[model samples]
Target: MAQDIITIFHGPQHPGITGNMSVELDLLGETIKRAETHVGYLHRGFEKMIERRTVLQAFTIVCRICVPEPDPNEENFARGVEELMGLEVPEKAKWLRTMVLEMARLQAQMLWFAGQGGSLGHYISPQWAVADRDLILDLFEELTGGRVYHMYITPGGVRRDLPEGFLGRLGHFLDYLESRLPEYDNMLLRNPVFLERARGVGIIDPATAREYGVVGPNLRACGFMNDIRKDEPYEMYGEVDFIVPTETSGDVYGRAMVRRAEIEQSISILRQIIRRMPAEKEIMAVLPKNHRKWEVPKGDTLVKTESARGEYSYYMVGDGTDKLRRVQVKGPSAVHAITLLEEMLVDSQLSDVAMIMNSLGTNPPEIER
Candidate 1:
């Protein structure tokens, strides 16, 4: 006799889910026989909404494309517009943008730590990681006047100059964050529970990763040395020195380790930026005298940025109008959370579904956007 096949939804409301999304699973006992991703539970149609708004108006909302890491979306959108408008950002702005990006990466990784631990039935990691991440958000509030959705990075340049002694405060925060790394390792990375569950689970072959368009830590976890910041340098990335950490295991633990190393790298990059940042007051480029009527030239361009999750790209078009002719975002989660995730979930235990999802850095907003 054949065993009964059970069908169930794993998310869209379950706390273990990464975001507002669900996974449809067909299970034979506790093992998943097949899986399908379900999205659209978010504020959908970001690309369409962007086309209806002016260039400046669109800039404000792009950050919503990925909540955990918004700076990459901002950077991609700003760079795409700048390229089309032939606008040159000030050298100081480039350094500032790079600093913001690294900080964003660090905070997102902290959030990841929390999710990874929480998904595994460990609660202490969330408390520690969220508290530490809030420190970075505090700095962002001081720098950009908003904690979560910072519309600070704009086309041509950043919104404003750094506040007085902001770098000094940032340095102190880095020092504190550095001290906490060992504690994080003890709580999650070195934890025996995390190891048993994460190791050898959700393994993505190196060739499979490339074929599926995987980028960032997930790709690096598969032993690929590919990083957009290194391969395709933009902003102040070309000026910095850092190593792309990789793991040959290609499993959940490997992905976790890559992100952990990157957190240290992010701290190192921020220190370099603070020491080498140029002193210039010119943050914003000269726009048309009338702000609302500003128009970009008739052309199209694609800009890519290495976000905390992976490579994020923006393909933009201008028809010589205040509103963009077209704007489409190609975020890493689009591939990571949908097809790749569905495939990875099959043949895995139902209990590991959320664990695998968090390991992939899946974000529903990015998928829906």
Candidate 2:
């Protein structure tokens, strides 16, 4: 039996790999007997780097913690600092931040469509979904000079007020995205081949989800309807109306369905923001005369937000100095890419490794950081 087992590495470079990470698997023929996650290539010591930087400086780099969905990182870091400093964010700023988060969620979901579909050999999904996701990125570029980093969200509030006519454009885009969801459903969700492949694949036991610290859609797939927006009500989330979708299967199909349903919910949340947000108001809270010289009283706070994948959290500490005493990021992928990935990969066929990883929404950058 020992002779029958063969070990293989499944990439930091392979096309099927989620990111700059690899999975080492021991296989008996095509079935995996053991699996281990490997990560390091993308690490930049972000938490340590933030400790040496001022609050505003740290804001600029938090987005780099998670590439596929960066807004949640910015949100957690900013909110944590705000809590520590006793800074009051403007009401309008809360609405704007909420809008940004929802947009990021929708864009991330679109990117996930590409990854999940590509993993299952559905090329059409990537082609269409990536292109649509670009449309959202275009908006991001307009809002923040940088498309990917988007240091637009700072500790006090947003960097600037909404650009003239930004709301009108966003409304039209939301309408377009709403119309496109049905097409995505027909293309992937309802496809019999995809359905059959995903139905029972990478099944995660409901009992283990919480133990493994699973969050977001993966946890929701287990029929646990926990969402920071609904449960914690940060920013303007409490003011909006949206559903938290859930499924009982706790399998690849269930996770896929949860995300697919969530796209519509994000769209609905964005619509509510557009309708209820104040027409004119301040976007940023008061800042010190010297931004770099700003200091927070000695305190620590943990901020949590629901990212596209799961719960994204940041632990921040200040020592009554301009620089942070410590900053720690607990990305959702930390659990999914390691514990859940390794456990689920065992007994799985080689053909389903990518499928399982995608279903779990493993983003390596977060793990390595």
Candidate 3:
């Protein structure tokens, strides 16, 4: 008698799967034999849509590139435009941008902590992480008037200056987060259940990681030190002092550990920004007489930033028109979700699919885009 092979789709709607993406699996019993990634379940044609819109109009769409970490998208688009226009951001504006980026990292990591717990059938951390994450969202609301999409970081500089006494409130939030770090460790990071499940699952060797274009905490988990902020300093990153955390395991646990350490690094960097921010009245640069009529010079440029998941990059082209000639978004998810995920999923048990995907931080919108 011949053995049976079962075919299944692991979540476009499955809670185990992240976002709105699915994996087609060929399974022998509970073990996945072959896996294929399927995206495009959410928004699509982001690059093509960007090509048709004015520079200002296109700005709104890039934030949707990575729903969990939109500031990196904004930073990349703004910096790419600035490079093409020969624009110089004020020193204070750069610090503000840096602060915004770090906040995004912290919040994204918090959500990941929740997802990691939920993936392993632990409900406690998810609730705690989400509530803590909301505090960060509250700070964002006070700063940008929006909780999810701030649209605060713009081309030449920030959309506006910081509100009165905002830094003090931000400082308080950081202190509270620092105090809660111990709780995170006790509840999740140090939990024996998480350790048993995550320690050896989803191992990606360092060479294969690089070959597949892996970046961010996933790559760092393999014990390779490759951070755009450290290797290629941008904005205020060169000015501030921080460390890139890495792990040797290259498994789910390693990735989790790297992100946890990163949360602390982000907090430290945030404190440095608060201490050394420049005192300047000018935040945003003077736009042209007609903002919509402003055109970028005829040239193309690329910009990259370190987001919580990995490196986020954007390529832009201009034909001396108010509308962009082209805009390309290359987020970490493009590689992690499809190429990396499919490769890692082979021979993996069905139970580990969601845990591994969440560990890799694959966002479906980024894959579809």
Candidate 4:
């Protein structure tokens, strides 16, 4: 037997950045010969957890799929349940949900900045990025009551209405972020070091990207403009005007530009939502008399939504009972784990591991669970 090549487990605790997960690598010297993903660390049986809980209880757990960017989980579960129940959300609530999703997008992008920028020996940019991200989270706190894992976006509608003058605070934050964009350009985007390291590094062809089902910034990096938010126009996205930024290069730098450009677009979308939102409307739909007793007609549904990382889908099966019969979460991590991460790791420098993982935004919890 060709003594199964020497392999080493790289994470789940070591050099975090990617969170609690492990990467099995077969290595020859510095080259990665093969890679296998493994982690039951957070295998919380989230789907089964969903099965035992009420529709409302289940929504709260799905966010754990990607803690760094959780709103999309809420949106999917909420939308799925809404469709099954035939609940019609009010106009204002629709707009508010859009605003919440956009805000989550911005937050996740900021965290991505921290991951990407720090991976390649740059620190200030990520620090600034994360610090600024806190402002948006502050807004989240006022609106939804939690910072990191917000259990706000529920089926039928949001948890609560926006605070008084919330738009004014949101508008100010947007202006602040907009003004700082140029500074980011000056410090990081224009820096020669960042350019040389990022420009042509980690190139992914458009065909491969599509075939593997890449989503979010990585998909856009391949010059494909496919954002479910824009293409499908859920919530109030149809009412807003914003462009999906894309790049032909499909490298680290291309993703950086795509994310940076989208920051402005996100802010602009928020401004539009604030302006277009109806002044008065019911925020939450009439929910079941008792959440624990809530049951949907026996059937199945798959809800798809664009998360910051990529295409996030929630598949639910209702057994005509309060508890769900089955739930499956299919996120972009599937590609990032078994496919893209494997292909991207061979012969790559040790330094690029984190950057590559960050660029892909692989959420281990999502992939394993």
What are the RMSD figures for all models against the true structure? 1.0, 1.3, 1.1, 2.5
Would you list the clashing residue pairs of candidate 2? none
TM-score preference between candidates 1 and 2, better one: 1
lDDT values, one for every candidate: 0.90, 0.88, 0.90, 0.83
* Candidate 4 residue pairs that clash: 12-21
Over 1-369, each residue of candidate 2 has an lDDT whose tens digit, in order, gives: 355889999887754345788989999999999999889989899888988888887788889888888898888988998999999999888988998999899989888889889988999999999999999988888878777678777899998788888888999998998899889999999999999899898988988998887999999999998988899999998878888999999998999999999998988888888888797778888889786778988988888999999998878889999988998888888998898888888898998998788878889988877
What TM-score would every model get versus the actual structure? Answer: 0.98, 0.97, 0.98, 0.94
Ranking by lDDT: 1, 3, 2, 4
TM-score of 3: 0.98
lDDT of 3 at 162: 86
lDDT of 1 by residue, 221-260 (tens): 9999999999989999989999999999999999999999
At residue 361, candidate 1 shows an lDDT of: 90
Worst 10-residue lDDT window for candidate 2 reads 11-20
- C-alpha lDDT (0 to 100) for residue 304 of candidate 3: 93
RMSD of 4: 2.5
Candidate 4 residues lying further than 4 Å off, grouped into runs, are: 1-6, 14-16
TM-score winner, 3 or 4: 3
